[model samples]
Target: MKLDKELVRDVLLAVEAHDEPDRWLAIKIPGKSDIEVSYHIMLLAEAGMLKADDVGSHDGFEWVPTRLTYKGHEFLETVRDPEIWRRTKEGAEKAGIAGLGMLVELGKAYGKQLLKERLGIDLP
Candidate 1:
């Protein structure tokens, strides 16, 4: 599946912050729209990279916690490939999104395995 780089990034951000129970980790990622974030979740599910656990719910919305499948982790590694890295860097350069620097920092914070868990695209 050709997951958008932006969406993949958001998924990784959210899964890494899985420890936080109050809100979504993707929300912390800079400048992402609501649709983009939600789409990442859907894509992850559709790709079978992310598994939804019935963590129950509050109010009308179900509170499902997503866990990374082994395949998902593998996929994330692909995201870190040199090719993808170059694309990411070029895109960031073109957009002048200094926030991408923060993503760089996040990549370091979460480690390589976390990336696979969140994005479902593996890195080289």
Candidate 2:
């Protein structure tokens, strides 16, 4: 299965929204399959954005994402705004950008651009 950016955002949002830090990130998005959610959580784990434990066998996935990392919070902050997310996606699509790495970078760039526009400050 291919990576879904929207689902990725949703997963991160859900994980961040969890109030109890002691509890694991348990996501259950309606209209999404369990395996799909598992897959996204697993991907987040692999991406070094989340601290998770893989407890599944070789057959399927069963992850327990504990919390987000510093990088995860940074990325989430960049793409958290709906307008920024839409522009980021639009810019990336126009540039034929793919992969999580590039996508995140584009989002960051868009976020910086927004800051520059709003505050006349540029981030290095």
Candidate 3:
């Protein structure tokens, strides 16, 4: 399955809101199947954004995220706002940069721009 950063962000938000541990539940993301969500969860775990347990039964393994890590929380904070996320994604796409790290940096820059605009104070 292809990596969807939006989905990743959504999942992180959900996990952050839940604030629980060891509870594996299905999260609903529009246009994404359960398997796809599971795949994204696995990716998040691999990215060190979440801690998950591989619970496989006779059928298959299910990835269950226990909680968000420090990095995950940081990333979520960077992309939580809808406008910031949209701008960050657009800037990254325009620049042809498609890495997670780069996207985070772009989001940070966009967030700072938004803050500067909101406060009308030039940020050095």
Error of 3 at 4 (Å): 1.0
Question: How well does model 1 score by local distance difference test?
Answer: 0.53
How many residue pairs clash per model? 16, 0, 0
What TM-score does each of the candidates earn?
A: 0.45, 0.88, 0.83
Candidate 1 lDDT by residue in tens digits, 76-109:
6645565555555565557555343333543443
Taken over the whole model, the C-alpha lDDT of each candidate is 0.53, 0.84, 0.82
- Candidate 3 versus truth, CA RMSD in Å, comes to 2.1
Model 2: residue 80 alpha-carbon error in angstroms: 1.1
Error of 1 at 108 (Å): 21
lDDT comparison, 1 vs 2, better candidate = 2
* Candidate 3 residue pairs in clash (backbone atoms < 3 Å): none
Per-residue C-alpha lDDT of model 2 across residues 23-110, encoded as one tens digit per residue: 7767898889988988888898888887777778899778867788888888899998888899988887798775678779999888
Q: Which of 1 and 3 is the better model by lDDT?
A: 3
Error of 1 at 100 (Å): 21
Compare the candidates by lDDT and give the number of the best one. Answer: 2
RMSD in angstroms between candidate 1 and the native structure over all alpha carbons:
10.7
